[model samples]
Target: MDLNLRKAILSNVSGHNTEQLEATIVDAVQNGEEKMLPGLGVLFEMIWKEASEDEKQEMLETLEQSLQHNQVQ
Candidate 1:
């Protein structure tokens, strides 16, 4: 069985509005289920593809700061 997870995820969210998408992301993150990781990754991939260079750099910096600040000492 060949399952295209990315395509599936995109299809699931195809017609979602901003609020719907935000709810989906919040639900996924708050649920903290391992199964939700792939969906989050798919969402991030779409964002990365559409992001401008400046937006991408901001995202990178924010992520870096988050990881650094939350690091386990």
Candidate 2:
């Protein structure tokens, strides 16, 4: 059984408007389910592919801050 998670995730959300996509992300994050991580990674992969170098740097910085904050706890 070959399950292509990336393609499946994209297919499920293809053609979604910005609001719809935002809602999906919000729901998944707020739910905090481990099963949602892969889907979020796939979505982030798509964003990474489309992001400019500056955008990528911003994302890295934001992630770094988040991790550092957690480390302080």
Candidate 3:
């Protein structure tokens, strides 16, 4: 069996506009299900691929701060 999860996810949301995409992300995060992580990862991969170097740097900084804050708890 050949399975392409990323392609499947992208296809599922292909026509979604910004608002719909935002709602999907918010719902997924709020639901906090283990099954949603792969979809999130696929979305992150798309963002990372499209982001400029400076944008990527800013995202990394944000992620680092989040990780650091988590460690302090």
Best by TM-score: 1
Off by over 4 Å in 2: none
Q: Between the candidate structures 2 and 3, which one is better when assessed by lDDT?
A: 3
Candidate 3 structure quality by residue, lDDT tens digits, 1-73:
8999999999989999999999989999999999999999999999999999999999999999999889964
Candidate 2 local lDDT, 1-73, one digit each (tens): 9999889999999999999999999999999999999989999999999999999999999999999889964
Q: Please list the Cα RMSD from the true structure of every candidate, rounded to 1 decimal place.
A: 0.7, 1.2, 1.3
User: lDDT of each structure?
Assistant: 0.99, 0.95, 0.95
Whole-model lDDT for model 2 versus the true structure? 0.95
Superposition error at 63 for model 3 (Å): 0.1
The per-candidate count of clashes, in order, stands at 0, 0, 0
After best superposition, candidate 2 residue 4: deviation in angstroms?
0.9
Local error of candidate 1 at residue 44 (angstroms): 0.4
Question: 37 in model 3: Cα distance from truth in Å?
Answer: 0.4
Quote model 1's TM-score: 0.96
